[model samples]
Target: MTSGPECPLLFLDVDGPLIPFGSSSGHPQDSASDTWTSADQGNPLLTRLDPELGPRLIALGCQLVWATTWMEEANEVVSPRIGLPRLPVVEWPASSTAEGPRGLHWKTRAIVEWADDRPFIWVDDEISAIDRLWVDASHPGPSLLHRVDPGKGITDADFSAFDDWLRLVIPR
Candidate 1:
């Protein structure tokens, strides 16, 4: 994932951030059921993705990158469903063994490396204090590790926060 100097990078996670894991009604509040039939798809969770989010995310003017276990499949399976283009996907390092400080997410180091000192935001459900501390100390540029609720995914409040941060960091 090469740095785009013009816009801050937004490392997006798919499972919990895009597809809310569990809801009180047992389905996402903004479920894509009307647009997509989950019966045919191998992964039912994909149905939880709201198509409206794509335009909202694009409106933020950040360079969005996939940072999920979904990998390239995020492009093949999730992109069209959410009206997103084929953005760059972060490739996770092999060897599942944890390499960084305890409580640091496996994707944290790779994501920071991908940013390469550029200002960036990581939107995921699993971001932890340790990950935040590590990034604060190691990453030279500005960064925001915004953790989403797995049960609710991203809400209007999250978008508002993103808009607020992007305005300060990129300045239009």
Candidate 2:
């Protein structure tokens, strides 16, 4: 598989983007999918996943990587439920060191480092102004830091934004 500078990387977070969690039980009407597999029985939250999202994400044509705390487990559990194949997982740095700026999320630095000059899109609910500013200052390639609503997960609007940015940044 061609990685490195050839393809744009999409760093996906599981807690919010994949599994929609709200005060009540329901998910976004449009984003919900009926696809469910036997593998999802282990985790109750897994039921919230819209299985069809896997195909949509694959259609984006970016190299998908797991950026969630779930780590390798993302491949083990989430992938099967969503109909995605095993994806690369980001190896987080040891947390014993100092934390950065006040608003900066812990994963921002690692995400940028993993990209290593390759263009990337980071989809997570925790992104803030501080993360954006840091990536702009530190990363050398085009980047899009998109924040999904934890309560709603990914919506049509988010996919549209991703598609629009990708069209401009990478050619088919």
Clashes of each: 0, 0
Candidate 2: deviation at residue 26, Å? Answer: 6.0
lDDT of 2 by residue, 1-172 (tens): 2455668999999998888786435542223334544454446677677777899999998999999999998897789767899999999988824477777888999999999999999999989999999999999999999999999888899999999989988876
Candidate-wise lDDT, in order: 0.85, 0.85
lDDT of 1 at 135: 100
TM-score of each: 0.88, 0.87
User: What ranges in model 1 sit over 4 Å off?
Assistant: 1-3, 24-40
TM-score of 2: 0.87
The number of the candidate with the highest TM-score is: 1
RMSD of each: 3.3, 3.8
Clashing residue pairs for model 1? none
